[model samples]
Target: MGIVLNQSLKNTIITYLGFGIGAINTLYLYPVLLGATFYGLTNYITSCANVIMPLFAIGMQNSLVKFYSQYKTIDEKSRFLSFTVLFPLVLIIPMLLISLYFYDEILYFLSKKNEIVKYYVWLIPFIGLCMAYFEIFYAWARVHMHSVFGNFVKEVGLRLFSLLLLIAVNFDWLTVEGFVYATAGLYFLAFLVTMFYAFGIQKPTFQFAMPSNSKEILTYTFYIILSGSVANLLLDGDKIMLNQYMIIDNIAFYSIATFIALVISVPSRAMHQIVYPITAKLMHENKFEELNVLYKKTSINLQVVGGYVMLGIFVNINQLYAMIPKEYSGGLLVVFMIGISKYFDLILGNNNAIIFNTKYYRAVLFLGVLLVAVAIGLNMLFIPLYGIMGCAFATLLSITLYSVAKLLFVVKRLHLYPFTAQTLYSIIITFILFILFYFWEFPFTPVLSIFLKALLITLIYVYINYKFVISTEINEAIDFVLNKIRK
Candidate 1:
């Protein structure tokens, strides 16, 4: 618990710092600097790369984490490590060739509405390849229980690089086209750094010989590809699909709205880094009781923290948007929809860790494939009808349904539920804060108003929760912070 809390806290801070830099790039710099069309084009390229990354990665990042601990001998571990590093290339090299063969046709389809995308179509594979190797090596570091450096690279490094690029563009130091190329270069650079760390953690002996359980590992890798792809599709698919049905510039507005909501998941993402390998070890030891406790605590702790982010975003969203250009203003509904989905994601806690580490992962994988189809289908139907709002609607429905299905499966198969009585309390607190602050506003500048409202909400909300002892975990965190202050 101590290690998990310490690492999660550090990770949460790093993630939020990254997100703050990203917010500036998205809301302030992109809209004001690049305007609508270029902003949308930039996001579309990255989103497409993310969607393609899992397939190129061949699920070896996940498979590495699951299988690395199975081998006992250093030689055997080296061989297994060698397998994870090399297996993905078998898929990546061929995919690159196929991409080259169909490059023109692919460009035509992707650039149907926004021909600007054609100029950068080649970046999709380039960025995807970099993202693929970064994760593979990041997972390598995770299994070594050295996740902070990886987290810093993942959460902060990219955004920091992006900030410098955006600044360059803003100051007339570079053109937008140059910014695009720099973005691709940044991803490749990050990949090299992560690969270096991975090797340093455990210098691979390059023993590429096959283990006896080669079949088992390859099988898991195959399923995890779909599993990995499903998550990316749900997160980035809406933006990609928007390019087909509507003006590509609309994604800029949608991106800003979703960014405000996506911040809610930062805690969950941070905690999951360390939790994943720990979950794997726990499951391997058959310690269902410990796993169950972890599941509930994570759910409640995430809910408590994520709930605050949701409140802060929703209550002050109007003011936040007011500061942005009017063209990006139709996203209140988008934020609400995506924000709620993010909260649901947080409450599920380490459910992903459990499912991915367990044998039943394939079942979840099949379910994910089905849901990806449903998400794409829904986007096709809804985006045409409601425009960007419709896109949000489709995402909300798909994510909600996906989360419910996951919760039910975990309950039925693992006999573990993340919900406790305090779960209801957390929701009630979030709702109460929303009700209290949603309509209240100070007649001041947007920044000052947001600060006062947030401070008031934090004070009243934390005081009430502490008084009631809503969660032992939250109470303990409060105590630890207070103790530190006194010392």
Candidate 2:
């Protein structure tokens, strides 16, 4: 448990480091150097490839984690890993080929004008394959409780490599076409790095022995594909939708704001990766009480961390955008909506993981697909009328519905609820903090005002939490930091 906590702390730090680099690249460098449209195209293309990669993955990543413990022998695990690799490739390869065949048609349908879509067309398969295998390798590492390397590679390594590409563009060393290819190429490189690391650490062998359990594995994989696809679309569908309905520049503006908003999810992402297998192990042992405790702790802690992050970004948004050009500032609303949506998911803790790892996993995903369909329908109706704000609103509603449904399902099936008097208390405390700060606008430059506002909000919020103990979990976290500093 201590090791898990330490590794999580390390991963969280690295994720923020990566976020810092991304903040510079997406919000400042890309928009300043490439303009909003090209930046949007870059983001949309990368997200499209990402969203589609899971479709090819066939849920093998989650399946790998869920099924690994069932195999006791070393050889059995090896065969299982090999089969995991084979399963996703079998589907991913064909899908890539098909997409390639219809590349031109896809471009025409996705864009309003005959833009330089071909420059990035080849990246579809390359990125899709890269992303597919990255998840596979990460899953392989995760089952061994060695997730920090994968998290670093996935979260930080990609951003570092992308930062290099941005530097090239900023320095006039690469054209937009070159930048696009570089973006795709970086994922492939990161995948390779993680693969080598997995081999070094797990040294998983390349062998197959048709376990009698293979049938169960295959069935799980099949359902997981649908599940993975739906999850992918729910998260990544907005960029795809934006690409289809608007210009690349709009996507760029939206992407910049989305990047900032995504910072709010760092805590959730770090916690989830470590918590998933832990939760699965608890379920496997029928330790329902432990699972319940974990659910509540995770929800409260995640909200504590994510709330601070969202507060920082919200309080500093105007100054943050002032750092960028005026043209890209329209994404401010997108940032707020998406940030709230993601933080809301954080508030639900590991509800999705609980559902996916349980017996009712398939039904959970089926419901996810229905919600995703509604999300797409709403985006279609909204993106055209309200542009990025519409997409943001649609996403917020869809994810809220999805989170509520999952929460209800878990409460019914497991008889667990991740809320308490503290939850309501935190809400009230947060609201009062917002109200106190809302009326305290100072007469200063936008940049100065944002800096002062963020400082005051941080101080006031912290003081309130300390005074009221809105979250004992958070108070303890603060104590830990203070103790470390004293040392």
Candidate 3:
């Protein structure tokens, strides 16, 4: 438990470091320089690539993590690793070829406005291949417990490069076309860096002789692809559908709203990276007691950490929106809706990592697919009437359903519960903080007000959690800080 908590903390620090860079790139610079429509185009392009990558990936990336520990000899593991890279290439080549053939009709249906749709034709493949391989190598690194480097590449490396490119555009050093090209190029570079790092750890050699377990791996990959596709639909499908049914600028607005809300997932993201492989190992060893402990601690720890972020965002939403133009300010409702949705996910703890890496992943994913379909249907019906807000409501409803379904599955199957008195106490504390800070007026510039409010809310949240001992995990964290000060 202590080791897992320590790893989770380290992962959170690096993850947030990446997100700190992303927060600036996504929330501020991209919107300021690119404007909403162009920003939407960038977000849309990335989202499309993400959705497509997992499809063509043929699930080898996931198979990499699950199978790595099973191989006794390094030679055996190397063969599995080689297949991880090759299988995806074989699958992705045909998928890309088919996509290129149908590019025009696909673009026509995906875009309501023709202006940016043309870019998608070529961009999709570049983005898809870059994203797919990024995950492939990232999975390799993760199984080795070297997840932080790949995370830095993902969280900080790409955004930092994009920030520079956006600055270049602002000074008229590059055109939007150049910036888009640069953005797409950065993703490939990030993937390359990840691959290089992965190779440093374990240089995979392509060998022809099939492993006796090749058929077993292929079967697992097939199920995982279905699972991955449904997961992407839940996460990325909203932006894709919004782009299809509405204008590009609308996606920009939705992108910003979603970006703001997505912050709540940062803690979970960091924790999950380390937790996934560990949980997989535990399950493989039939260590259900250890897994149960992990599930509860992660849920509590994530809730405590993510709850503070949600409180900060909700309390200071008005001031935060003031940082952006008024055109983007109307996204506050979207922010709240999505923020709440992420909050629900946070409370579910590592329910996702637990379920996705376990034997019962397919069943949980099927339930997720059902909810995702509802989200699509709702967004299709309502986005025309309500625009980004419709998208927000659809996302909120769908995410809530998805999170609840995940929680239920974990509980019923594992006989585990993440909720406790501490969970209720955290909720009460967040609500109280929200009410108190909700009405308080800090007379400062919008930018300054956000900083001041965030600081105060963070301090109060920690103090309250410490005072109440919200969870043993956070209490121990506080104690560690205090002990260092005393020493």
Candidate 4:
């Protein structure tokens, strides 16, 4: 718990810093500098790249974490690490060749509904390749318990690059086209920096020999490819599908709403960096009791933190939209809808790590494929009717079903439940805070209104949580911070 708390705290700070930077890029800078159409185009291209990245890497990032702890000797570990690093080439080389063979046709197909996309179609694979390797290298470092630096590169470094690019474009130093290309280049740069950090942690000799578990490793990677694709698809498929059914700028509108909602999830994402490998280690050792304890604790801790963020967003949503450009304000409902699904994700803490690391993962992969179909079908059906809000509806429905199914599967298969009475308490408290504060309006400006409401909400929420002790872990965390402040 010491190392977990230490790294998780650092990562939470880094993730929020990244999100803060992203908020600037998304809400104000991009709209002011790039305009809605180009902003949407940028987000759409990156989303497409994300949807393809899991396939390009072919699940080696997860495979490395799942298998790294199983190797007993340095030689075996080195061999396994080398294989995972090189394994993605199996798909990358062939995929690149295939794309080249039918490049124009592919672009033509993708840009049919949004022709602007054809102009930047080539950046998709470039960014996808970069993103895939970044995760692989990040995982490389995570297996060595060096996730904070990798998290910084992933979270802060890339967004900082975007800020620089935005400034360049704002100054007439580069065209919008150049800005888009520079974004891809930044992803590649981040990947290289992460690779350097990973190798600095443990430089591999690139052992050519395969580990004895090659067969098992390859099999798990194959299934995880489908699982990974499904997960990423549900996440970004809405934006991609929005391109097909609606205009390009609608993607930007939807992106802003989703970004706001995604803040509810930063805690889980940050904690997962270190907790995932630990969960994998515990499962590898068959330590169910300790694993169970970690699982329950993570769920409550995430809910306590994530619920607070959700309350803040929902409470001050009106003020937030009031500050942003009017055009981007249409997706307020999208924020609430997506935020709920993400909260469910938090409540199911480390569920993905548990599933992906264990033998039961195959069942979840099949479930994920079915959910992917449902998500795409829902998006195709709903976006035409509801527009950007429809995309959020489809995502919320698909992700909720997926999450509930995973929760049930984990309970049945491993008998490890992440929910408790305190989980219910957190949910109720979240709604109480939302109802009390969300509708309350201040006579002040949006910024001041947000501060006043958020501060009040935080005070009430924190006092109740500490008084009733919603989560002992959270209580301890608060005490630690208070003690540090006193010191």
Best by lDDT: 4
In Å, residue 219's CA in model 2 sits off its true spot by 2.1
Candidates in order have lDDT scores of: 0.90, 0.80, 0.82, 0.91
**lDDT for each residue of candidate 4 in 1-487, tens digit (9 for 90 to 100):** 3888889989999999999999999888998899989999999999999999999889999999998988899999999989988878977999999999999899888899888899889899999999999999999999999999999988899998899899989899998888888898999999999999899999878977888999999999999899889999989999989998888989989999999999999999999999999999999889999999999988998999999999999989899999889988899999999999998888899889899988889988899999999999999888888898888999999999999999999999999989889999988988987888777799999999999888899899999989989988878888999999999
Candidate 3 yields a Cα-based lDDT of: 0.82
Model 2: lDDT of residue 164: 85
Arrange candidates by lDDT, descending: 4, 1, 3, 2
Residue 20 displacement in candidate 2 (angstroms):
1.0
- Model 1: how far residue 92 lies from native, Å: 0.5
Q: Tell me the deviation in Å of residue 79 in model 3.
A: 0.9
Ranked by TM-score, the better of candidates 2 and 3 is: 3
Off by over 4 Å in 2: 112-114, 442-448
Q: What does the lDDT come to for candidate 2? A: 0.80
The residue-level lDDT of candidate 3 at 309 comes to: 85
- Which RMSD values do the candidates have, in order? 1.1, 1.9, 1.7, 1.0
